[model samples]
Target: MTATPRTAVVIGCGTTGTSVALALTAAGTSVALVDDDPGAVAEAAALGAGTAWTPGLPPADLVVVSTAPSAVADAVHDAQSRGLGHVYTDTAATKDIVCAEAELRGCDLKGYVPGHPLAGADAPGRDDADAARFTGRPWVVCPYETTPAWALETVDALIAACGAHRVDLAPHVHDRIAAELSHAPHLIAAAYTTRFADSSEAFLRLAGEELQAAVRTAGGDPWLWGDVLAHNAGPVADVLDRVAGELARAAAVLREGDSCAPLELAPTLQEGRRGQLALQRAGHGRTARDAPAGGRG
Candidate 1:
């Protein structure tokens, strides 16, 4: 952003979009917040995320989309067709479907870039939209062969503006990693939480910090997560299948309680401990690409 992009059009005033709008606005970029939900638009505007959108507005310098996975392709196509911005990008979790949809629709690819941010809000909607939500987060950018340098830079500008780090990855590799990192974990959380969903208060009293923390993602929108799961079904299913195998093996060992059962579980327990420590260490540091600038609420 040598020119310092002045105006931005943010599509979908959801958690990511609202936060992005607020961060850009705080950085002195005039933002236009658009969403189908009138209440959400009003809420975002009230929070100073951006001005409420109206039709027939002037074209913006950039457009950042944070729409649902199923709607992402059509949204980008429409935005580009309408010349909503000089550069277009999205924060959708799954990239293959959106990119494929844009290609099928013959969308102008010169200004289009695909991205995903690793961090997530504890909840959704305007109430949970934190302008600093992207801080120190790993933001992945998947640029195709034809993706122009300027478009990639434009998105990198947004990532920098949001105080997030930029990571470049191929689309399929990003998808596979995302499945293991996010999609499978969300499903597992829901599965783990469901065991106590209808349990008696007395039975639930046994739950500990580990159980609560592990199932935190169960608090998210089920329908929205289901849509993500459907779009990335292949990779997500593969990860879940592996998880199932491990669980089955553990169950078998517990049930049989053979002489080697303790030895078999020892490696699994030790490996899990190492994984936890690795994740904790990863969280304690900042990536070189993160700008970590001043952010708005």
Candidate 2:
């Protein structure tokens, strides 16, 4: 039996929200784009994304909260209280807190999925929102056991409509991994990149593609990154401690020279190589088979 096309209401109209609305519309879902910013809503609707709205809009079949993690709980509650949607989902970067709040608020967890798209451009705003933004990228879907089967299917279908691949993860697991893979690295990049700015003009001139690429994420939206780091501070702190320990070991190895250098550095270097391989595999839509075989001198 063919299911009826659902009416999807996307709140926020930021980059992520606009993109999702476009994808849903492309998939034959009637969409209404809502945002506190009237201009943003108009821009998205101008692009044929959906109907623009300020608030107090009529209910929809699906309500997608694409706001910042901090705003997700309120958005979910508002949608639920208005009976706005049959199924609700969020595109917040952090999941654990949002999921907990949803459960606490007595929102319909059975029809809620916590989702995060693992891709975005350096720029922010609805202007940067593109249908191709999430193409071939990983979209994490964290569905609870009580999550309705229909809700899961609807969320998965929407993700696919965005041209992204879906991966199922537990909310806590997603938070931890996101901390290690994205949050910590962004923090480090923002710190390290600032150090080079005060160097001599010639020194800065000598900076190459590798250096630029390494620090690119440092240019991300500060408020967004700040919230992300704060929300996942505990897990991020654990990863940072391990990183600090490894750095100390590497420093000692360099001081000791050949006598113990290889011994101390081998594992760290190998782990890094394994991480690179895993990222490469993920990019190529392959499972992280295992650690790549190697050691370093």
Candidate number with greatest TM-score:
1
lDDT of 1: 0.84
TM-score per model over all chains: 0.93, 0.84
lDDT of each: 0.84, 0.81
TM-score for predicted model 1 compared with the true structure: 0.93
lDDT of 1 at 52: 84
Tens digit of lDDT per residue, candidate 2, span 1-297? 124337888988888898888878887888988788888888999988988654565566678899888888889888888788888889988888888888887777887888999876555666777877777678999998888788887777777777777899998999999998888888888878888867898888898989888888888788988888887888888988887888887887798777767877888889889999988877554323221333211
Q: Which ten residues in a row have the lowest lDDT in candidate 2?
A: 288-297
In model 1, which residue pairs have backbone atoms overlapping below 3 Å?
A: none
